[model samples]
Target: MANTPSAKKAARKIARRTLINKTRRSRVRTFLRKVEEAILSGDHEAARAAFKVAEPELARAAAKGVIHKNTASRKISRLSSRVKAVGAA
Candidate 1:
């Protein structure tokens, strides 16, 4: 339905961006899941290690606009707190 050449180009760009964003989102989710799995397994050290990896991924995703800054910060805060609790246990 994009009749104008500019509109067609914009559509193509959007499609490409969508794919890239989806890939980024999936990678972020995978990292988060790894952290959650480590936490659920009750291995504080493993969870900390996973969190160290995931934290940067989440921050990168937010910086790239794949997710909101506040959302990423909230997730990092909660995960860090939980990881600390695991260590205290």
Candidate 2:
């Protein structure tokens, strides 16, 4: 529990930031899901397109501090690999 006025205000700010971060994280997940679906469905073109859209969303999320930069880069790398393999297959 926050006792001082400043502490209470800080708590409120944390709560607000939590909600915003949750939404940002959820948005990133939604984009990732789209890419995964496209990949799973074996549509290379769609997968590539979805990846195109998802890549920037991931980068933006990392930039906004919703996710770590390395995490975003790793996900992008893995997805790009899968997309390339899909094309090869």
Winning candidate number (TM-score): 1
RMSD each, Å: 0.4, 0.6
Candidate 1's residue-wise lDDT over 1-89, tens digit each?
A: 99999999999999999999999999999999999999998999999999999999999999999999999999999999999988989
lDDT of each: 0.97, 0.96
Clashing pairs in 1: none
Lowest summed lDDT across 10 adjacent residues in model 1 is found at 80-89
Candidate 2 backbone collisions, by pair: none
State every prediction's TM-score relative to the real structure.
0.98, 0.97
C-alpha positional error of residue 37 in candidate 2 after TM-score superposition, expressed in Å: 0.7
Candidate 2 per-residue C-alpha lDDT over 1-89 given as tens digits, one digit per residue, 9 for 90 to 100: 99999999999999999999999999999999999999998999999999999999999999999999999999999999998988888
Worst 10-residue stretch by lDDT in candidate 2?
80-89
